[model samples]
Structures are given as structure tokens and as C-alpha cells.
Target: MASDGSPSRDTPEKQKRKKKQKQRVEDDEEGRSSDGAEVRLDDDDDDDADEEKRLEKFAEEDIQRLTAAGHAALQSGDNHAAVKHFRSAYSYASKLGTRRVSKTCALNLGAAYVEAGNAEKGLRVLQRQGSSGRVADLQFNLGTALEALADAMEFEEAVRSLLRAGESYSSSGNPTEAALALRDAGKVMLQCGRDSSEEILNVLTNSLELSMRITHSETRGRILNTLGLLFSQMSLSSEAVECFQQALPLLSGNTQTLAVVLQNLGATHNTLGEFQKALSYHKEAAQLYGSLGRRAAQGRCFSNLGFALMELAEIEEARESYTHSLLAFKDSVCEALGAIRLQMREPEKAVVHFQEALGLLSRCQDVSSSVQERLVNKLSEALQHKLILQQRKAVAQRRHSQRLPGAAMRRPDVLIGRREMMNSGGNTHDRNQVSTEFHSEEPEKEDYSNTLPEANRNLNNTHDETDTGQQVISSQPENGPGEPSVECGKQMNGTLPLVSGTVTPPPGRHKATPPQRTLKSRFCTVM
Candidate 1:
């Protein structure tokens, strides 16, 4: 012990025994400390495992509670509240490390954002969660977000997203959603007004095909009706009618929808010139609208009914229908009524109606200049017709007053004498001289010369055209054998030249050839 380090505590033998005892004591203390540490470590591990399970259970419950609230909020139309609840659910699910529930919550969050009109936010949420897989619901919500962003996106991008959504739904056995997505795509194309008709048709047709798989009659009917309207806008009247007819029976339980289908059918049939069918459909639609207390819609239906009746030539029925429209509401039907009146030759009534329409239009803020211009033109036309009719009446009244009883009695005898002279082999010169003497002698006879000039002047002042392509005011009286008679106020090159209202001789008597004037009857119809 004293060899180099420290002083010895005991002798060699006794010290050996004492050293063994101290070593034993040190070993016992070390073993006891190790055993205590092991026991504490085991207790800590068990507590942590139990705590993690408890936290996971709480997180799952919270996620479920939040998801339920989000769904309830969405159904109640509180999209903002839905977004809040869904966002919390998503956070809880993420914290719990649940991939499946996390995805579900993400989808809910995105849909809530979309419904809230925050499409950009929804799109970002969906894109983040959609990276893992191709999900039908996810794709559908993504498409909706894209469609809502249509104003901010190019047409091609908007359409491509919708198509992808539709395809995904189709592959995932969700025909209804697929159909809706495709239908939306078709609507986008139409609204863009840039796609070809054929392309739009193909897209709509695919939607229709998918819609046929739907078991719910009302939903299918609505889809079909929407497609029908799109077809109508594309000018596919035949296909549109077919679609409307198919939807009519399916949607019979829904009164408003049924009425709309009937109205559409009526309009399409009218466009196809099937006025008889159109009249029936319009009547049914009008009655439905009346029952529904939709006064404005009923008025529109009656107006459409009037158009159909007019096309069928049922003038009285058409007029009655138009009156019904006017009673329901004072709309553009006034102009239509004016047109009908014009067709019936009631120029005074037409003028009144036209003026009323112009006044009504003036009061409306949305009236276009072109519409006002057309109404003004119609009023001018009615006025011109009224003036012509007044002139004719005045001329007829003057002629009636100027006629003498003696001249009327002598007219037959004069005509009989002229006929006898002509039948008795009179020479051309003698016949002409007799005609001249007869005309010169009968000064009291109906002298058209005085009234003709005024009538011709009035005719020349108006810009109206006859159906014959020329406005013939009056015919010239028969002239002598050497002179040729000419028609008065006939138009050449569609232009009416001013004349002195006097009959002029032809350039060459014997060889004079007059232009052939064909008299045609003109008929006016409602627009």
C-alpha cells in the first residue's frame, strides 16, 4: 500500500477481508441504482403509449364532430361556416396522421370554399390533396372550381378541366356527376361563342347519354330540358322538340318545370311552322302559369299563343289572345297589337297602339335604339296608310255629291248609242269622232278630270309601293284614233317621277307601245 500512492488503511490479511466487504457494499449500491432507473423508465414508456392512444381517440372524435358540423352547415347554405368547420376537421385529421380521413376532410374543405364563391382557394386545396390519386369526387369538385373561375381563365383551360372531371366520374361509375360535368362543359362552350356547332353538339350528346342512366325521373327531366334549350339555341329545332317531349312526361309531377317544358315546346313548334301543336302547348302553358300565380309568365304564354293563332290565320282568336296578354301586363305586346291592327286595315287603331308602344318603350331604361327605331317606322307607315285612306274617302264623297240624277239616267242611253254605232260598221275616224262628241257633249257626266289631279298629286307625295311594283294612280281616258293613251303616275326604276296630272300623247301614235302594268293585290300580315 505504501509502495507509491497512498497510506494503507488495514494490515494485509485483515485488510483483504475489509476490502472484499467494501467492494461488496459498492456493488450492492450500484445494482440498486440501476434497478430503480429501469423501473422508472418502464413506467414512463407505458404512460407515453397510453397518452398517445388517448390523444388519437380525441382527435378522431373532434374530426368526426367537425365533419358533421360542416355537412350540416353546407346543407343549410352557410358556406362560410362550412368552410370553417371543414378546415378544423382537416387539421385534426392531419394531426392524427390519418391519410384517408385527411383526404375526405380536404375534399369537404375545398367544396365549401367553392360554394362560398372562393374558387381560387378551393382549387388550391383540391390540387394539394389530389396529387396522391385520381378521385371522382375530388375531380368533380376541382372541375366546379375551374368552371367558377371561367371569367379568369382561357376558354380551352376551362373546358379541359371539365372534360377531365367528366371522364374521371365516368370511369368511377358516377354517371350522374359525369353527365353534370359534361353538361356544364357544353354550356361553357356555348357561352364562349367560339366553339363549333358540331363540337358543342358532341359534348351535349355525351351528357344526354349519361343522363339516361339516372334513375330519378325529375333529375333526368331537368337535365333533358337543359339540353333541349341548348339545342334550341343552336338552331336544332327538331332535336330540341324531341328532347322537350321526352322530358314532359318525366317532369309531370313538378308543375313549374312542366310549364316551362310546355312553353319551350310551343316555341319550338312555332319555329317549325307547326302552329296547331304550338297553339295547344301555349294554351296549356298559359293555364299552368295562371294557376301558379305567375302573372308575368302567363302574359308571355298568352303572347306566344297569339303568335301561334296568328300563324294559323285565326284572326279573331289571335286578337283575343293578344288582348289577354295586354290585360295580364303591359309589355311589348302593344307593338304586336299594333301590327295586328295594321294587318286588319284599322290604321287609326294601329296608330294609337304604335304610339302607346313607343311611349312605353321610352319609359323603359333597357329599350334598345333599334327597337325604338322599328316602332317609329311602323308608326310612320300607319300614318301614311291613314292619309291615303282619308284621301280616297274624300275623293269618293266629292264624286258622289257631284253626280246629277239626269246625267245618271242619260248614261245608259249614251252607252247604248255608242255600242249601236260601233256595231253598225262605223269607220275608225267616225268611231273616234263619235267618242269625242259624246265625251264633249256630256259635261255633267262624272268628270274624273277634276278629282283625278288631286288624287294623283296625293299619291305622288307618299312613298308607299303597291304589290304590282308600281303605284298606278289613275288610267288615261280613251283618246282619238291618232292619239295613244298613257297610264298616270306609274313608277320607272322604282322611282315615281312627278307628273303634271295631265294625260300626254305618245311619241308615235300608230307605233306607240305602252309598258305593261300588272295590277297585284297586296295583303298585310303581322310580324
Candidate 2:
């Protein structure tokens, strides 16, 4: 190295010193003094440290600002905007190595993704960054997102996610969330319809225990209801009844909840072959639903009530309940009947019912999108069945036409073909017209109960409590009785067959009459 009491500029040492001097000069210029002179650079190391600290602090401030913006967006229901903000916050907080901020931002990001319906993405975000003190909240959010994803059809994944959520919540000491998650898991397991009975029982048991510890009556009621349903599924009628009874008292404050409890109670009693009790429960539920202005729920209660009535052999009353409930559940009714008719080898009647159902469904605007889709799918199946029937009929007709020797050739052939086409077209037109006409009328106001036998009419007018504990109450008729009542036949499936005037029995069997006990139809469950 060359030197003038120092290393030469060409040497590595001299070159390093020159670079340092240039950097100091640049730094000094960057922070110039008032007199246009370079500032003293005594603590270069300290300045670098200060600069790094400032950068970290700025990053933290940005994360805070972003997180705040995300919350504001979430509160406004602008999920997409919230997701964007949270994503940015998460990135900044992560880069700065701030665990608390990063975790919070990540949680926010996942929830925003879920709210935006990007469930898979949300689940991924939570899974990666969700193992912290707030595990309970994160897992709950994850489970909910998975649920949404599963509804889009990833059932196994959703089940696993919900189980994970329950465990996480339990570990985090949040029994309430843990119980809810476990309950959801049981529901999902039940939906799968597999042999997961033991798992379901375990989860439901844990859920029940946790729910009992909570002070919330509604939550307790819901847990008890779910347990009752599970018990019913297992055919443990006594246990189911006990659970339902326990739930009923807790759910009294909420009309809809009380109605649901009553309906379940009715269902349980029906399963136990207690028709009268089931009828009583269903009637109470229907009245509650009516008071709450829940027509759909009321309709369901009526349909269930019809089932109890049929079991009790109250055919006339059952028919009336079925008709009333049909206003809301026509698609289900038609679909069931169409399927039954198809099974019975009555293709033509099945096709007619299916077509009528579709036409009526086209006018229904109050159903949920999911229900509408299901109805449309049923209609499609019905159309396919109708097509198959038509094809079979055409084939049979062609075979018959072939068997009849065509001596007159083209003339007879043309006449037969034309007639077949005309008949088919006419039938279709008639069915469509029937559908249109039926739709035009207010079906809810129509009462077919007037057609009951005179004996049945008396049964309707005065409450009858026989040894069988049957009860009946009649409402004011819209147009009074349409036709004069008839005397009933003996052994008419526990109903009096309609004929004119007084009741009479068959030769061998005696007429067994029950004592009248007039009670209002709308009896309260609480009373």
C-alpha cells in the first residue's frame, strides 16, 4: 500500500474510508444546518437505530389505522371493503413482527372474508394464523365459514371444522360457544344419516351439560329441544317427552319459541301413539303461531294436526286441516301424492297432479329461494315421469294401431293420428284451464268441512270427550252447509258416512256414544 502517513486511495482500506466519507456527507446534506453548512455526524449508529424504530412505529400506526377502518367497514356491512383493509393490516403487522396486532388483524380478515361469502379463503386465513389467546373466537368464525362452505357442499370438511371449533372453545374456557358448536356438530352428523350415534350422543350430552350452566333461558330451551329431537330419533319416547317438558317452561316468553316447543311436544306424543295429547299440543301451537302472525308455522301445525286427527279417525276434521294447510304446503302435498300415484301405477293421475302443482307454484312468491329450488326440482322429476308415461302410452297405441290391419291404408292412418293428437291437446288444455281457475280463487277461504255427516256435524258443534278423549269444535261457516247432512254408515273408518237425517247402526254392532265435554278448540298448553 502507498501512503502519505495513511493508506493509498487505490487500496481497499482507502476505498472503504472514501465510501464512508461520502455517506456522512450525504447524510449531513440531507439534514442541512440553517447556514448552508453540513451538520455534525457524531452518532451515526444511534441515528440508524432511531430510523429503524421510527419505521417500526409508523408500521404499527398504519396497522392501527387499517384495523380501525376495517371495523368501521364491517359495522357498515361493507364486507369487501373490510376484507381489503384487514388484509393490509395483517400484512403490515406481520412484517413488523407484532404478534398481537397480527393475530387481531388476521381474525378480522377471516371474519370479513366469511361475511363476504369467500368462506374457503376465510377458512384458510383462520387456519394459518388462528392459534392464539383468541382461539375461541377464531375457531367459531372458522366453523361458521366452514358451515357456509358445506352448504355449498363440503360436508365432511364442515363436520371436522365444527368439531375443531367446539374443542377450541372448550379449551378457551367459553362453555357457551363450545356447547353451541357441539350442538351444531350433532346436527351435521344427524344430517349425514350415518352411524354416528355415539358421537352425536356424546356431543349433545356435553352441550346439554354446558347449557345447563348458562343463565340464558332461550339457550337452555334450544339445547333441550335438540336433545329431545335426538332422543325421538333414537325412539326413546319417554326421554324425549321429559326433555320437551323441561324445554317448554323455559321458552314461554318467546311466542315463536313456545310454538316450536309445543309442536315438538305434539310430534313426540304422536310418536308415542297418544293422539289426543298430540292433538291438544298441535292445536295450542297453531293458535300461538296464529297470534304471532306466522302463517307458514301455523300451516305446519295444521298439517301435523291433520295427522293427529287422521290417527284419531276424525276423517272429516282431518280433511279440513289438510285443505287449510295445503295453501302453504301445496308443493309438498302434490309431490307426495304424485310420488305415491306413480308407485301405484297411476301415471296419468300423477302427471295431472304434478302439472297442477307446477302451475300453482309458478304463482307462489312468498317461499324461500331454497324451497323454490326444491319445488322446481320436484317439478322437473314429475315432468320426466310424465314424459315416460306419454312415451309408454304412445308405444302401446302404436302397437294397437299396428295390430289393426290397415286395409284402407293412408285414410284410416291419418284419421287415427289426427284424433290422437286432438285428444292429447284437449286434455292438456283442460288441465291448464283447471289449474288457472283453481288459482284464481282464494283457496284459504274455502271450507270443505260442510260435507261432513249429520252425526259428525253434531260432533263439531258440541265438544265430545269419549273414553278415547277425542275433542272437536266448529267455526262459523262461510256460506253455511253447502248440502243437507246425511246419516252416517256404521264402521265408516271411525267416521260417519254422509247420508240424510238421523244416525243409525248396522245389525250386529251397538251404537256406542261418548259423553259430550264442550271445550274451546284453542286451548292453551300452559293451562
Best-fitting candidate, scored by lDDT: 1
Q: For residues 1-527, could you state the per-residue lDDT of candidate 2 as single tens digits? A: 46557664567888888887787787678785433433334466679889999999899888888887876665565768978988898899789886777787777787778777787898788889737767666656666677667563555565676677778868777666677677666655665555366776787778777767767786677667666655555556677688779988988886666776787687667666787988889889878755553444555577678878988899999988766566545554564466556556575776676666566556543433443444455455446556655656775777676667673575677677868876876765664564565456436433212211121323432222222222211111111101111111111122211111212111111223323211101000000
Candidate 1: give the clashing pairs: none
TM-score of each model, in listed order: 0.55, 0.50
Clashing pairs in model 2, backbone N/Cα/C closer than 3 A: 486-499, 486-500, 487-499, 487-500
Candidate 2, which segments miss by more than 4 Å at Cα?
A: 1-78, 151-161, 193-195, 230-239, 327-527
Per-residue accuracy of model 1 over 454-509 as CA lDDT, tens digit each: 12322322234422211111112211110111212212232122121222221111
RMSD of each: 32.3, 18.4
lDDT of 1 at 499: 23
Model 2 accuracy (lDDT, Cα) = 0.59
Write down the TM-score for model 2: 0.50
